[model samples]
Target: MKRVDVAYVLLVDEHEENVLLVKNKGPGASYYTLPGGAVERGETLEEAAIREVKEETGLDVQLGGIFSVGEAFFEERGHHTIFFTFTGKIIGGEINISLPEEIEEVTWMNLQQAEPYIHISNEFEGAIDSKTTVPYMLRDAGRYRS
Candidate 1:
């Protein structure tokens, strides 16, 4: 069995037409993605999200609630990642490029505009489009199923 990991976040400024996204740094980095990272040992999923956002963007946020959850499997790497998506509100801090070593750029974009830049995982895309909250699953490199 492959190892599993968790990545979740509180998406700030979601009320606005556009939400913030980050361009990753280093090789194999995707086009753009929400600010989040792997859950650390002994930490809650919510804590991981909060820490990741701060580490990646230097923005402090208050977690609103869980928006969704999904599973993704990286076949080539033999890893299965389960993500908990949460809504968040920006409580403090300004947008500053803090983790330049890990993040290349940060930008706010409308959903439609973000589509092109987002690392297209059907699971993530479906979560954005769904009318009701649902768990989106991505396997290999295909559309979200179930």
Candidate 2:
């Protein structure tokens, strides 16, 4: 199986009561997910997170540290994808679905209201539940030493 790296961002509004989500345009169009996508060749995980948010949601954001990591294996596609999720702040740019082919709409929803549409698999299951207080699935998935 081929390995793929993807980055996602959780952008909370000023009140911290709402989260930014994007509705995809294709088959799973009814579902909503955090703004993010596949990391491009030679792009850092941080760069990809920022870029995907901008491209998918038309929002310019500055990412905080990566908060969680999840893995998924697609047997049919032979893809083993590792997902890196980060917390981010909106620095500029307005909400718009720049990439219509990939995204249908972008909106903010409270944790409870957003819960049903947000689905996750594998290691991401517990971290992102609106039933609790914290919204983003924040976990210490790595450590660095020099």
| Candidate 2: stretches off by over 4 Å | 116-146
Going through the candidates in order, what is the number of backbone clashes in each? 0, 0
* Cα lDDT computed for each candidate against the true fold: 0.69, 0.77
Q: Which ten residues in a row have the lowest lDDT in candidate 1?
A: 135-144
Task: Write model 1 residue lDDT over 50-139, tens digit each, in one string.
Answer: 888888888898776566666778988788878777667777888888878778887887866765543446656744544344443334
Clashing pairs in 2: none
lDDT of residue 34 for candidate 2: 89
CA lDDT, candidate 2, residue 132: 31
Residue-wise C-alpha lDDT for candidate 2, range 5-68, written one tens digit per residue: 9898878787778889998866643668889989988677887899999898878998776656
